[model samples]
Target: MAQGENGSIHENTGERSPAGQEAAQDTSLAPRRRKPWFLLVALVLVAAIVVLIARKPKDTQSSATAGPQIATIKAATAHLGDIGYYVDALGTVTPVATVNLYSQVNGTVTDVHYTEGQMVHRGDPLIDIDPRPYEAQLEEAEGTLQHDRSVLAQAEMDLARYEKAVTLQAIAQQTYDDQKLAVEQYRGTVRNDIGQVQAAQVQLSYCHLTSPINGRIGLRLIDRGNTVFSGASNPLVIITQLQPVTVVFDVAEDNLGQVRDQILHRKALPVDAFDRSQETKLASGKLLTLDNQIDTSTGTVRFRAQFDNNDLTLYPNQFVNARLLVKTLKNAVLVPSAAVQRNGTQAFVYVVTGNTVKIQAVTELTTEGDVSAVTGIDAGTVVPVTGFDKLQSGSTVTIQSMQAFDSGQQRLERTQDKSGSTL
Candidate 1:
């Protein structure tokens, strides 16, 4: 230690003055500045390592599932079952018997016996067309009939007397013959009078209108006090048989042979009718009959089905869709229709064996809804339905149900979204 001239403390150097001290100080500060930069570089490297560690599991999982190395797909199994073959066509609801009822007698409508939209039975009175006139006519006919009957009795008595007298020769032969002829003439006249009386009775009965069948009656055209005539242009009311109705539909010519064979064999083919949207079943019925000839314009044939519409689910002239079950492939190889893939002229399916898939060629026999009957594949064969775009023969796969696959995909997307937000 040395004392300065003004008694200030001073650090002793061996051979450097204040300028040399400043140079030494500068050299010592250089190492300190360089150490901070080295620490910064080390911190950057540590951050990079931490990030890699955090993302390691995610990368492993994503790599395992994201690519086509092991495709996740929806799958199903082929099994032995019965699949229906159906023919679908638009149909119309029709009533078995519809009648536009009109008055049969020329008279005023004195009383209406039925309300609009009424249910009627056979022989139920529907209207009274001035029955007072009918009563008079019936009375006249009865009187005439009684009088003719009396005349016929008298003629028969006279004929007996003429026969007896001719046999005994009590009168001239010519005179007896004339009497016999006159009696015969009177008997014939009586018979004709009786016929006329009956005709009048029938005409009188026509004044009272009655239902001829059991059915539902539509709107009434003739009201009380309205006059109506026989064979009028417009009907008084409409009646339709509803309890046992029918549906008529058209079937394509392609299916005519099978349907005709079934009909010939007297097999009752079932038919189901649906609404316009085909989302609801309206009625069920059996095949009634088919048209005798095909319609050349549409290459189709008409079919009629009968339904016991106890519930009245169908109406006349209403449109519907019909499904006819043609046949069933019993104990056949059945698979999901979605599993069948087409490549140009070839149909194939992805048959899953263990963790890999192999393309199996198949022939689709028929499809009903979501199920199909196919050939060239045995029962209980596992097959893949979805994730086919990235698949090929001998490709590895992870079997999953449609729900599971969708859930996994959702989770992966969520993970990716989280990662992006963090960045």
Candidate 2:
């Protein structure tokens, strides 16, 4: 050991005093302790900065994906063609003529000339009644007529003799006049008897029941051997004409002017009948006549259309839907009715171009089936029919399908069948 300045003791190597050595150790420890803490703090700051940087991109991506999505829709193109204007109405099929047959004389039904539901022509015998009593009455009238006629002849002969006697001055003028008056009275009696014979003949002919119209017979109300009377409430059978059947339909009174104009200008306007679904066409006919008065309660007018029901597609009292074609618009701008949307009273459509839609105003003239005759939009313009709810004035759109609308009824019917809806 050695002694140094300030009385500090040193080790055998003469290195330094205890105070200097402690000071050096303290300085080195300070640097080591500060280095670990500074490194830990720097690492924490770096982790925070890296986390912020990663989160910024995630947030930006979330915002970008959260924007409004494009809407998908179906569209159709407008067509330039003809569209028929028609008036629709509910109708009932009626027979051209209906007749109920009843016996005109009281007698037993001896024979039935035809089967039930058989077709018969006018004056065709339907039922044969026992005419024995009527024949007897006719014979008695004939006998009385013969007796009266003989008496008249005898009286005429006597009058002739009296007339000659008067001319010769062998008889008084008063007596001759009486003989002439007697002859006249006998002649009048003969005429009366002849009239009675004719009446009896008519009564005898009534014993045979015949059809008054050409038609199909209904169920027989009276059977053979059953008694029938002229004044009976029940008829023997009912006959209805099937061919050339008539359809009675009621049209809205507001459309009466158009229908009347067409009828006046074009005779026998075309009419069509359809089934309950209004898809199946049953028959075709022509406008026959209109009722004398309109039904005030329903604001409608009854019109009759006649059809040549050669195929018997129409039946008496059958219910059907009628459509009368009044006019046809040529070179009309037509579009699908589904594409038209009403904003209050104004009609509008979404015209799509380049994946974007623009609201367009259009004038709708008339709608028939799934088509609408419109004005404003030109033919060949694309119109969106679906996705209207997700759209605005300038919304983006993705067309799922684009179809061509036919002005003809073929495509219209096909669409109806697919959707099972009216439009």
The all-Cα superposition gives candidate 2 an RMSD in Å to the true structure of 10.9
lDDT of 1 by residue, 150-257 (tens): 877887787788788888988778877777787777777778777877877788777777888899989778788888888888988788889898889999999999
lDDT of 2 by residue, 216-266 (tens): 999877889999888898988899999889999999999999888877886
Each candidate's clash count = 0, 0
Worst 10 residues of 1 by lDDT: 403-412
- Taking all chains together, the TM-score of candidate 2 against the true structure is 0.79
How do all models score by TM-score? 0.75, 0.79
Best by TM-score: 2
